[model samples]
Target chain A: MKDNIKKSYLLNIVGILSIYLILKLLIGGNVLNRYHISIVIFICINIILATSLNLATGFLGQLALGHAGFMAVGAYVSAITAVALKSSGLPDTLMLVISLLVAGIFSGIVGIAIGIPALRLRGDYLGIITLGFGEVIRVIINNMKSITGGAQGFTGIPRIANFDNVFWITIIVVGILYALTHSRQGRAIISIREDEIASEAVGIQTTKYKVLGFAIAAFFAGIGGGLYAHHLAFLDPKTFGFMKSVEILVIVVLGGMGSLTGSIIAAIILTILPEALREFANYRMLIYSFILVVMMIFRPQGIFGTKEFSLSSFLHKLRYNQIISPRKEIKGDE
Target chain B: MAILQTTELAIQFGGLRAVDNFNISINEHELVGLIGPNGAGKTTIFNMLTGVYRPTEGDIKLDGVSIVGKKPYEIVKQGAARTFQNIRLFKNLSVIDNIKIAYHNEMKYSTLEGIFRTKRYWKEEKKAHQESLDFLKIFDMQDYANTLAKNLPYGKQRKLEIARGLATNPKILMLDEPAAGMNPQETYELMDTIHFIRDKFNITILLIEHDMNLVMGICERIVVVDHGKIIAKGLPEEIKNNPDVIKVYLGE
Candidate 1:
């Protein structure tokens, strides 16, 4: 069993790395144009945002609407750090790494600060509180004229987040989140989502897991923000407003809350959908709204529900005969 | 020695005393039942003992150690675990995962260990998987280990709840309406399982049950309550004959 687990982990890492390499090769060979590369990078950033939000909303069962606030925090902080380090003649990769880490940690700290008190509220109450917090964050950024450049936007952030960098970082973020939710701690978080009272009764420190989930989610959102800042070479408080948070939430809900794969899939589709429909550019928002409304009416639990797509499970199913396997019967029970 | 004891435990929601002057003493390996009519504060008493409600007044001790004012998970760590009146399994999770989650406090691997899949993580995870599976086997649910908890039949869900409670390795297990929705056959099997666990685990059991037959058949001693106060306490036969218990609880 241990060997099997180890093998699966290795397989997953290899699978992701190969995909990264393939994308890198395509881009380097100029098979993918610059416009497509930009879209791919945007998709990666959205993936990170959606997965992180999914941790809070999907796994922890907490509706958090201040995700973009954390992202803004990450974006500004990392961009500032990268800009400062650029003058120091540090390696670009090193500067980028430090900036992302700083952004993630700072955002995580903020997440804890907010999450501790905010988690006390549930459902829509929590949502409203987080939404207020996001606005508050944006307002703070807006007023900090010297540091954040006010409504004019913070500029001159180096474009360090190319397709390769953002793609790899997204994989790492997704991997960490996946590892967490699959562990004992992750199970505890999920249990809280299932039933908080029961989770406490069964010896899970509900508050601790709740905070952990929120903090981790915030950390990744921050990373996404940092990547966005570097990719776009700009930062605006307006970009991290409540609408941005809602956009991420929409991705999570559309992807299936508890499934990481669902988030990835939804992020890709949502990011590219507007650009792909460039011919009807004027109607993009309408199209997006229509799809969301239709999706909510038809598959409210999201596309994947809480079930994740597992490569090992898929392979195991293929290896065994459907007619002879008890596993098949077990799957049928679901 | 008593494994769990509550004295002068009381709670008031505004002016109404939800559970006033409630008391219970459960000895090691004893199967006890708390039976009361609807809204008789039976579940409220369980709530107080499990730290869901801080008593407006009173003391609760486990092994002579005061556990009053501790958190619910803290109380469980001190060797008490419970099932809810409504079964509270992690519905989306698998049956084994449900039991494994109850073993959360028991897992010694740190967060870093889990993330890195350290040697300790692998060893502990394998052990947890085996232990959870063994626990499911006790209820003849080993085959359903991979099945989602919500997909399980109602009777099995209840059984799984108990299984999960036991996985916490509590010295005293508090069950709320274990037989509430069970058919007679399931209830009968539950009774056997309860007996088996008490003997096998050498743990005291405190059960809140609405079914008189179930309570009377298994519980060596029964505590009957009405209006948040104990009206009668004695052996099952004595409780059955007690006029106050019959009037308040049996509605005779």
Candidate 2:
């Protein structure tokens, strides 16, 4: 069993590295146009946002509708910091890293602040509280014209986030999240989702884990927001409204809440589906809504349910179960 | 010395007094049973002891320290663990994971260590896994370690709930109703398991059960209650013969 675990880890690393190399080669060879590159970047950002929200909503069993609020917080803070540091003779890369960190921490702190009071309620009450909080964030951003540029949207932000930078960052964020959900702390959060009363009876501080999960989800959402601000070189409070939060939630729900791979796959498909159907631009949202309704009616647990896709496990099942094994006389091949 | 002691424990729900003036003292390694009819406030007393519902008035002490108003998790940390009457297992999680969740307070690794899979993290996790498997072995549930809790047979689910509670290494293990849905054969087997656990762990047990046969079979001392008050307290033989107990069970 231990050997199998090690082999799977090695295989996953190799798989990811190969995919990254292939993408890099395609972009370098000019096989993909600028529009395609931008879309890939958007997919990466969406993956980060969806996976983070999955931690809170899917794993923790808490419904939060203000995720884009955290994203907006990260965007505005990072954008302001970047603008302030641009003329301070700092390296662009260093400034970008600092700004993203600021964005993540700021949003994480806000998550905790909201989670404290919001998590006191459960089910639809919690969802409604988070929704209100999201709107409150937008209103705050709108009124703070000095820093956020009010209704005009914050501008003059540096564009440092590219395909390469975001790709690596997204990998890091997703990797950390995956590791978290598989760890002891992650188990505590999952138990809360399974049965909150039983979780408490088993010596788990349900409130603490709930707040921690919410804060971490907000942290990553903020990071994605920072990347967005840099990529667009502009920010609009209107863009991070309730509907934006709904879009991220839609990706998470469609991907299967507790499955990171599901989020990633759903993020890619949902991001590109509209672009692929651009001829029906006027009915873009209508088409998207129709797909979502159909998906819910058929598979309410999302595409993957709570199961993760493992390449090693799939290969093992195929080789051992489906294919008949020959006489085991040549077993020393390894 | 008494491992658990409750005095003047009471809780009121608006105009209703759910449990009033409930008092009990359990010594170390004692197998005590609390039995009463439905709505007799038996579970309410259990709730107060486990910190699910704070008593409107009274003091509960574990090893002589008052635990009143403490959170359920805090109470567990103070060496008290409990199983619910309705079999509250982590239904979606594996049986082994359910046991591991109980060992949360005992795990020493931090979140950072867990995220990075540091050496300490791997070591602690391996230890926890082995310990959990050993627990399953005691219940003869090692084979079902990977099975989801909800998929287990009714008897096994009850047994798993007890095993999960025992994983906390509590000084006092409170069981709300271990045989509520079990067959007679399963109930008989549960009697032996409860006795074995009490001897093996040397922990105090306070169980709330409705099955008189199971209660009489295992509990060394039994307390009978009716209408939020203790009606009789003695050996199972004495309680079976007590006039007040007869009145409560037979309804005047």
Candidate 3:
């Protein structure tokens, strides 16, 4: 078991480095242009968003709809922080890191504020309250022109969150999230999802776990927002509206809730697919949604269901051709 | 010494007194059966005892401390745990994980320790894993440890629920119709399991079962309720012969 853990850790580091190096090489050689590089960065940002949202909507088993509200808070907070820190003579990278942290912490605080009240309501009520709160955030940002620049959009951000920063951030964030979901705390969170009453009956503080999960999810969504703010050097209250929230939800649902690997894979495919289909022009959205509907009808559990895609397991299966379901084997034996 | 005591505990759902004047006292290591006909407020009493419902009328004392309006999880932490009448395993989780969740509160590692994977995380996690396996071993369910709860056979599911309830390390474990769906052989095995667990864990047990053979065969004392009232209370044989119990439940 120790050896397996070591092997997986080594494999993960190698895999991450390879992807980074390949992308870096592409950019250096100009195989991918500026527009394509931006799309890749967007994929990373969206992966962060989808995985963070998955913690609440997937692992926590709550239908949260206002994730964008948290992201909006992060973007605005980080943008403002960066603008203020610009004249402080700090190194660009350090300033960017601090701004992102501030963004995440503030977003998490807001998440806790909203979560305490909103989490008390379950299922659809929770969803609606989060949605309402999300809209409230957008409207507040829209009205607070002096600070947010309101409907006019906030620009002149540092543009420090390049592909170099975002790819690594996405990897680190997802890795931390993976560790979290596989731990003792993650069990409490998942148990709530599996059976809330049973979880409560077994001495889990359901309300505390729910709020904790919500706050963590919100915190990462804020980090994703911070990355976006600098990458594009812009912030639009309109970008963090209801439709944007839906866009992130679509990615998570498409990836299979509770599966972080699914979120990353789905985020990549969904982000790149539209860009690849830009030639279709007017019929693009219709085609994209049509594909989604078909995918849902055919495979409703999304790409991976609730199962994590394991590279080791996949390789073992390839070698041995063994069946995965123990129940099936037991039934057959009987 | 009463480990669990409830006095005049009652709840009314919109003027319908579902359970009124309910009183129960069980000593440590006692295996007591709560028997009642359908809709006799047996489950409701369980709910109130476990803090699922706040009783409008009386007080519940666990180990001589009043526990009214405390949440169900809090009650579990205070040395009480219960299984549902309808089996409610974490169906999506593995069998061992179902038990591990009951051990959630007892594990001391913080969330930050979990995220960072400190040495304490591995030490505690390894201990939890081995112990959870030990728990499954008592039920002789070690082989099915990795199987999802939903995929388990009906009898095994019932046993798993009992295992999950016991996992909380409760002073008094409550079983709600544990043998409800089991065959005769399974019920016999469950009866033995019930007796074994009560002695092994050295905990009091409050059982709500319709199977007279299992309940009467194992329960040291029996309390019978009918229409939200205690019809009779005594040894299982005494309750079996009691006129009120016979008229309401036995139906001679």
Candidate 4:
């Protein structure tokens, strides 16, 4: 048992360092250039957003349509903070961190406020309310003429987010999310997703867990939004509108509701697909809608469904390797 | 003495009183059965007891404290756990995770610890997994620890539900028609499991079962109901011989 844990820990460290190296290579790689790096960063941000939304929608089985609203909250809060604090001579990295934290806290607070009332509402009613709340947020941002710059959006923000920073943060956020979904609390939330009554019977505080999911999703969306804001050095209410929420939802559904790896894969594919089809940009949405319809008809659960790729499961396959090669020293035989 | 008591508990939907003025007292570690005809308010009573619905009028007391309007989770926290008539396992979650849901009430780590994977998180997670596996082993479901709940057979799913309830560590565990769709052999196995759970855990059990053989063999006391009222309450032999029970069963 101790050996298994030690091996797992060591594997985790190696995995982190390798990802760090890959991220550095991606950013510093001359092959793809600057535009591709920006695209990669944006893809990471969307993956973070969609994965967080999947926690509430896919794993928690709550249809939330206002995720973009949460993103907007994070974006604006971080934008305002970075701009206001820029003169204090704080390091750019510190400013970015503080802004992201502010955005997370603000978005989380808003999420809780919206979640408290909507927790009791079920199914489509929840979807509608959440959608309404998102719209309300967009309108609020649009109407806050002075601070948000209204329709003109918030601009002149510092550009602290680079490919490397965004990449590291994305890895951290993904790790955090992955760990959470596999943890005990994640199981409680997923139980509620399965059947509310059964979950309640098992003594899970369904309301508390539901809200926890929403707050956690909001926190990540805020962080991602902060990254987005700093990446662009400008923000607009129009960009973080209802359509953005739908786009994230598409990523989640296309990925598979309860599959973490599925969300990441879907985010990457969807993010790049539009850029790849730049010639038919207007027809891209039409094709996207058509694909969604087709997918729903044949495979409504999405690509990976609810399966997670576990290291333990991979380790279990080592016996087959031994069966194929009896004499060779198997790495799994340690 | 009764650990749980209901006084004149009533629930109504429109004009149909699903459960009317239902009263029962359950002692600690007692295995009691609730039996009835098709619409005898058996499930309604269970729902009321578990706080799925507030009684239109009445009092449900746990350890002498009224809990008529408490939420389902609050009732659970007050030492009441339950399994549904329909198996309701988190379909996508692993068998171990299904049991871990029940342990949520006892988790000491905050959201911060969970997000950060702090030391406290590891401690709580280790405890939760070990505890969940302990319950799973009772039903010989340890091998399928990582298998999704929905993939399990019907019998295993039923057992998993019971295991999940036990994970709550409740003083009172309620089973709603556990043998609803089981085969004869499965039903027989379930009866043995129920007895084992009652004796080993030393917890009170309130069960709803249609199978007379299983109920008679295991239940210390049985309560028979018709429409929305309790018609008979006694030992298995007494209930078996009750004219009112016969009438309801025969639709006379």
DockQ of 4: 0.59
For each candidate, give its TM-score against the true structure: 0.95, 0.96, 0.97, 0.92
lDDT of each residue in A1-334, candidate 3, tens digit only: 6666776577667777888999999999999899989999999999999999999999999999999999999999999999999889898778888999999999999999999999988999999999999999999999999999989999898888888878888988998898888788999999999999999999999999999999999999999999999999988888898998999999999999888888989999999988888999988888899999999999899888787776555555688998464222111010
In model 4, the Cα lDDT at residue A101 comes to 93
Each model's lDDT: 0.87, 0.90, 0.89, 0.84
For residue A13, model 4's alpha carbon misses the true position, in angstroms, by 4.1
Q: Write the per-residue lDDT of candidate 3 for residues B1-252, one digit (tens) a residue.
A: 999999998899997999989898899999999999999999999999999889999999999999999999899999998999899999998998898888898789899999888888888877888899999999999999999999999999999999999989999999999999889999999988988998899999999999999988999999999889998999987987888888896576
Best-first order by lDDT: 2, 3, 1, 4
Q: Model 4: clashing residue pairs?
A: none
Backbone clash pairs for candidate 2 read none
Q: After superposition, how far is residue A279 of candidate 1 from its true place, in Å?
A: 1.4
DockQ list for all candidates? 0.72, 0.61, 0.72, 0.59
Model with the higher TM-score, candidate 1 or 3? 3
Ranking by TM-score: 3, 2, 1, 4
Candidate 1 lDDT tens digits, A1-334: 4465556667676777788889889988999999999999899999999999999999999998889999999999999989888888877667888999999999999999999999998999999999999999999999999998999999999888777667778877887887787779988999999999989999999999999999999998999999999999988788888889999999999999998888988999999988988889699889988998999999999988887766566666778734232222112111
Q: B115-207, model 1: which lDDT tens digit per residue?
A: 767778777887888888888887799999888889999999998998888899999999999998888998998899899888888899999
Q: First chain TM-score in every candidate? A: 0.93, 0.94, 0.95, 0.90
